[model samples]
Target: MGSDRTPIFLCAALLLLLVVGLFIPNWLVFLFTISMAKGLVVLGLILLMRTGLVSFGQGLYYCLGGYIVGISGQHWGITDVALVFLLVVLAATLLSSILGLLLCRYREIFFAMLTMAFSMILYGILVKSEKLGSTDGFIIAQATLFGWQPEVEASGTWIFALAVIITLVALLVMHLYFRSPMGFGGEAIRENEIRVEYLGVSPRRLIYIKYVVAAVLAAFGGAITAVAAGHVDPEMAFWATSGEFVFIALLGGTLHVAAPLVGAFLIEIIRTIALDLAPYTWQMILGGSLLLIIFFLPKGLWSLLPKRREEEGL
Candidate 1:
């Protein structure tokens, strides 16, 4: 347990990474920017996994986030980064809230398949929509911060900075969430929903809450990705995209809040280097890498760290 000032201390320490980020190479910064975006999505998976729910259709919200930014700028000329992010939040919340009603009733493989089906439906719709550029997709407008457009050369840096800020805020919220009883309600559900119900908690309600939170986080990640890449496509909502998210989620593990980011960076670095070294067999490299991790670090890469006394008891 931390004191009231823990957030202050944690935020200061996390924000210091921004200073280090300023010194990294441009390519590295871009890599990290995208990694952090995907990491945000995986963070939501971590939350859901702890509750014994695996969503294979997370790309629905991720795509919504990107499309919100893209269509807003294209049709409505809304390109302010902050405003589009707010739109992403609202859209994700609204849609997920509706779907979650039915989704929350399912568990295990049924939940997974329903999620994937919904994602594929969006992918199909995007592929057929002519104005949205069909399968080729369309470019989003360059995002501005509060109407202050960054120079072309500095736009990447601006996006990276936004990524940093968003990552920190999301991390802080998750840190607090995991410490609350509702957070533990998830784990308790995972262990035994019957026991959780006996304690006067509604497991379905908890799952619904987790599902919505995960969707919002995934959408936010998509918005960042759209702004950084300046593109949005039907592929963003495809089932394969959701599978990749699941890959990163497993690669990172669900043991800790930061595990997803750590895993995302590792996976990205591996994929980048492997693609350079063996483009034809990059997938093999990822498969092999995951096998090795599963063999040696069954709990995930986080297990490599020395355990604290409190964790040892867990």
Candidate 2:
């Protein structure tokens, strides 16, 4: 089980996926691409969740990231995927870094609501912009990668492979992070902020770092989603979108960095099946699934993995 987290295993898995994705149907590739993107957001959310904080406004960064990518591609003529992601990092870092200063002071429900409120602020602004299509939104320009333009016919496959590569990188970084002293700081803060500070560590500082990281991951997710979907709209920043990320976080469990990706793929599968079976009542289906998962596996789907059995009578 520990071997799975190693960089070698991750790279091998990505290569296998790239090979498989080349032959898969475009629709399947698109669905998985979006799932991988969302998994990135959930991975970020888990960072905050471990620190005993939740952001119902993660969609704020997600939306902002997509809009920035779309605007840059459409208006500024920046279509290279690599350059676009750099822009996303810059924007997300600037916004979240400033917000974290004030936001780190809050905890529990206050933190969640403040995040949501800020998210809605952006939502309201986008909804009012006339040229940006108001509620209608707009399509993004086709993206190229390192000057390699995938033909329109093969774009889905190209993006699927790209998403896989990106997701693998995020997973490896987070794997190392969750093992480091600083990564464990969030857990310490979550268990007892007072005790953590008694040890000379500043809880607020940790929360600030975690919050900023989470926001940036969310923006990265948003950027990927925008590229995969070829469109962006206000709905991406809605409370429901943020709620979905939280839902995915819970469904995946916080035990491992890869959990979010597994949870996202499961969600996409469930959502696709639900929409096919019950278009009008899909929410009920999802709600029911959530209840079942919560009741049956409170630790989330990651708990289903075989445990690393302790050394026998060592």
Candidate 3:
């Protein structure tokens, strides 16, 4: 029981945070959920990077998920949250699979460039899409959780719960996947595709699978983000947005599951604070921080803690 108490304690702590957030009665909880949603996409990016693949087009799947849910619920009369979620997952998997097949053929810079191209193309289409609300975007009408009509006031809390749930499920899936044979093969391919090829494992297939998995995760994040943000736009598919995902991933370091989420929360908080305090130079401040982090600690904030722990150990 003592050994199994870690997860119990962690859950309790998170529940405490949620309860406290609910009581705050402002945008704190909403801000947290937004950070989590962004974290989810960044976490997917980190996974891809773990396999030595730097995808610059995660926004493609992200936008696809958001657009699908927004368009479906707004136009198709589907208001069930779970149904929309399922649809987003299915759509994202199919789209990512179709795209990954071709994109996985390239490696390194070429792979990044190809992914960026695809995402930019999607962005262009969305910008020109009059029916999809073009650059103005479309608002998601409201969503229902099962049979319960969650009040508009409780939207942020509900979204927080959803983001937390999705995060947990994704963590479990990824942990299991990373420990599985296919996951090991993918890592091996990342390290050295030639060696993996020599061992009878198909590098291309592994890369494709990894790419598709990442896309699905990114799409899931995007769909929930759309619901949380209450809107979807062409900007979701933009190259700059994709870069944001990668930035969070790098900021947190790809070593642990929680790193990207932590990075997401921290960066969002910093951005929020900076925007509030220094509206005129928020971009400069944020950019400066990122540059400092990259130059001083390439492994990200996670590395600092570990390094400190190591120094203490010595």
What is candidate 3's lDDT per residue for 127-218, written digit by digit as tens?
99899899999998787878677888878888888877787677667755765678667667777889989998888888888888888888
Ranking by TM-score: 1, 2, 3
Model 2 lDDT tens row, 1-314: 23333567667877887898988888888888999999999999999998889999999999989999999999999999999999999999999999999999999999999999999999999999988989999999999988888899888888888899888889889877877788989988988999999999999998998888898899999999999899999999999999999999999998778789889989998989999999999988988998899999998999898755331111
Question: Compared to the true structure, candidate 2 yields what TM-score?
Answer: 0.95
Evaluation by lDDT, superior candidate among 1 and 3: 1
Off by over 4 Å in 2: 1-6, 309-314
**Reference-based lDDT, each prediction:** 0.88, 0.90, 0.82
What are the candidates' C-alpha RMSDs?
A: 1.7, 2.5, 3.3
Candidate 3 — worst ten consecutive residues by lDDT sum? 1-10
lDDT at 37, model 3: 80
The number of the candidate with the highest TM-score is 1
* Better by TM-score, candidate 2 or 1: 1
The lDDT leader among the candidates is 2
1 against 3, candidate with superior TM-score: 1
Per-residue lDDT tens digits of candidate 1, residues 1-314?
Answer: 42445467557855776777788888888888889899999999889988988889999999999999999999899989888889999999999999999999999999999999999999999999999999999999888878798898888887988998998899889878986899988988999999999999999899999999999999999999998888999999998888988888888788777788889889999999999999899989988999898888777888787765544543
